[model samples]
Target: MTPPHATPVGPDLPMPFTHAGVDQLVSIWLAQLDVIRDLAEELTAEQWAAASPCPGWSAGDVVAHVLALESELHGAPLTDHEPDWAALPHITSDFGRLTERAVDWYRTKGQDVVVAELIEITAWRRDDLAHAWNADSDPNEVVTGPLGLELPRERLIRTRILDTWVHEQDIRTAIGIPGGLRSDAAWVCAGQFAFGLPYVWGKKAAAPIGATLDLTVTGPGVSFERLVQINENGRAEFIERTATPATVSLTLDWPTYAAASAGRLNSDSTGALVANSCRGDDQLAARLMPALAVTP
Candidate 1:
C-alpha cells in the first residue's frame, strides 16, 4: 500500500529544481524519448516481442505500463469520481485493450504515424504532470496510496520522472542501445529513487557508525542521489551515496552505475563497494553483482 503522498524511499528533504537539475531532467526525458523514437523507426513484429529487464514483461508491456501511469495521473480512468476501491480487473482489462490497440495500430500504420502517436502521448503526459505538480496544493494532501505515508508534491513528481527514465532504459536495452545512458538523467531522476532507501534498506544497517563511502560519477549535470539498486539473489546491491555515516557504501561512475544496475558495466570495469567497511573491493563488488535483474 502506498500513501497518497508518501515519499517513495522515505522522507528526505526536498530540493527545489535548480536550473541544472531541470536541464538534466529534460535531457534524461528527451534522451529516453529519443531511444523510443528511434526504435519506433524500425520495430518489427518480433522486436516488439523481445524481453525487457522486467520478468514477464516485454517491450510492449513496458510501453503499456507507461501509458497506463500517465493516463492515470490526469485522466478520467483514474478520476476522483471512482468508488473508493481499486477496480482491479477492470483496470487491467481496460489497459490490456489499450495495449492491443496500440500494437495493432503500430502494425497497421506508417513509421511516421507511429512516431506521431508516441509524441502525442508523451506531450499529453508532460502537460498533465506539469499542470498537476506546478499547481499550489497542500503538501500534506491525502494523495497517498494505502501505504501509511504522505509525500509532498515534489516527491510525487519525482516518481513520474523515474518511471520515464527507467522505462526508457527498458526500451533502450531491448533494442540493444550501445554504451551507457547518454544524458545525466540518473542525477536528475533519482530523488524518488533516493527517497526509497529507508524502505529498501528498511531498519537494516549494513555499515558501522560513521563509516565513510564515496559515490562519484563522471557526468556533466546537476547532482541528486544516483539510482539505488539491489541484487537479484538479494545479496549484492548498488546505492547512490558518498562517504558518510551509513551502511554499505559503493562508488561507480554515474552512467556506469546506471548501466551496472542495468546488468554490466560499459568499460568492462567493475565498481567498488565497501561492505561493513571491511570487505575488499573485489569482494564488495561481488556482493553487489546480482541486482541487475530488478524490474521497475
Candidate 2:
C-alpha cells in the first residue's frame, strides 16, 4: 500500500555529481539525520511498533538501524550480539544478519532510549564529519565504508546520505507521515538510484543489443529524461540523443521511481506498479521492471 501522499516529485536527473563536494554531501547527510531524529522523537509507543517497509523491522527498529550504523561510524564499540537466525526468518542474507545484530540489540531497550541514542549518535557524527572533510578535500581520496569496503571519500558520504534518506522515508511511511520526498537529500538519493539503471538494463535485465529504452521520471524536484541503449558491445549506456526509436518507453513519478529502484516495488503490497506507464515492447519492459532494483 503505497501511500497516496507519497507521490512527490524529486529534483532533476543527473545530479551535479562533479560539483557536489564532500562538505555539501555531509550537509545533506546531516539534514537527513535531522529529519529522522525529529520523526523518531515524536513517535508514540504504538507508532514505534508499526511495521515498516523493511522486512521484519518496526519503525523504531529502522531508527535503531540508523543509530547502530552511525554509532559504529562514530567509533562506538560493537556489542557481542548475535540474533538467533532460526527465529528470524525474514533475514535472508549474511549482510541482513550482520545488521540485524545491532538492530536487535536496541530492541531490548525502550523506544525513548532508542530515540535518545539516535539523537546523541547523529549529533556526534555531525560534529565529526564537519571536522573530518571539507570542500577542497580530494573527493577521490579512498576511505573505508561499512563491511570493510574501500570507497572514495565523496562516494562514501553520498552512500550515507542515500541510506539515511531512504530509511527516513521508511519511518515516515510506516507511521503514515510521508514527507522528505523533495528534500536535497531526496534528490541525491533518487539520482543515485537512477544512476544504477544502466546496470539494471544491461546486465540484470539483459535487454537485447541495439535496443533502446527511454525512461522519463516526472518530478518537481528530481526529474530527468534518459535514453539507454544497448550498444554493439552488449553494454547499456546512456546517450544524449538517438535517431532510432526506442524499443521501450517508461514514464513514472519520482516516488514510484525511487520505490521501484530501491526494490520496494517487488512486493504487491506497495501498489507501485500502478503508477508506472509503460509502452513499446511489452516483453522488454517486463524484463526491465523486475531488474530495476540495483540496491542490495
Candidate 3:
C-alpha cells in the first residue's frame, strides 16, 4: 500500500518525448557515456571515493561498474579476477558480483586510471555504434546485457541507456554536481520507467480487475500522463483512455518520482511526496503510487 502522506498536491501539465526509437536510444547511450565521463573528469580524489546513493558503492565504484560492463562488451580482460564478495550482502546477483569484482580491481589501480579507461571505452563505443546501428536490423535479436542476462538487442540497449543515465545521477548526487535532469538521458530514463506502471499497479498493488488509474508526472521541462486499467483479461494494461473517469490520479514533479522509483526516497519521504501530489481517492492513490516503482 502507498503510505499515507501529508503533501500530495501539484499542477497539471503536458508530457512530450523529443527523442525515441532504437537508433535514437543507442545515440542517447553514447551521449550519456560522455556525460558520465565528463562528470568523472571533474571529480577530486576524495569525491571519487565518496559513497554514492547506491548502497556500499562509491562514486568511483559506480564509474568502474560502467567501465567493467563496457569492457565486457568489448571483450577486454578483467585481469586476475578474484571473487571476494561472499561477505558483501548486496552482491547477490551475478551482475552485482561482476561489477564488484571489476570495481575492486579498478580501485587498486586508482581513480585516474579508471577515469581514463572510461573515456577510452566510451570513445570506442561511440565510434563503433555510429557504424553498427542499423534501423533495419532486428531489434529482437538476443544479446548479452551488462548483467549477463540475455535480452533483445533493443531492450538491452535501452537498459544500458537507463543504467548509464542513472549512474550519472548517482555520481552527481554523491559529489553535489547535479545537472543532467534536462538531458535526453533523463527523459529516456523517466519514460522507460513510466512504461512499467501497469505491472506495478496491477500485480504489486493488486488493484481490482477493471480498475482505472491516471498519473501525471511533471519534471523539469517535462509533463506526461499515463492511464493504467485492468482489462477483462484481469491484466493491468496501459491504455490510451478510459471510457469512464479515472478511479484515481497522481501528480508530482520528476525528482520525487525518480528518487522514489530508485529506492532513494524512504517510505516516509515517499509518503510525504505522495501526499503533496495525489488528487482523488487518497486511499486508492496511496495503494497504487508506491507500487509504481518496479526497477531493480
Q: TM-scores, in order shown?
A: 0.53, 0.91, 0.84
Best by TM-score: 2
Whichever of 1 and 3 has more lDDT, that candidate is: 3
lDDT of 2 by residue, 186-232 (tens): 77786687678788888887888988878877864566677788889
Off by over 4 Å in 3: 1-21, 86-95, 241-245, 279-289
Candidate 3's C-alpha lDDT?
0.74
RMSD of each: 10.5, 4.3, 6.0
lDDT of 3 by residue, 252-273 (tens): 7776677666666556776776
lDDT (0 to 1) per candidate: 0.44, 0.79, 0.74
Residue 220 CA error for candidate 2 (Å)? 4.9
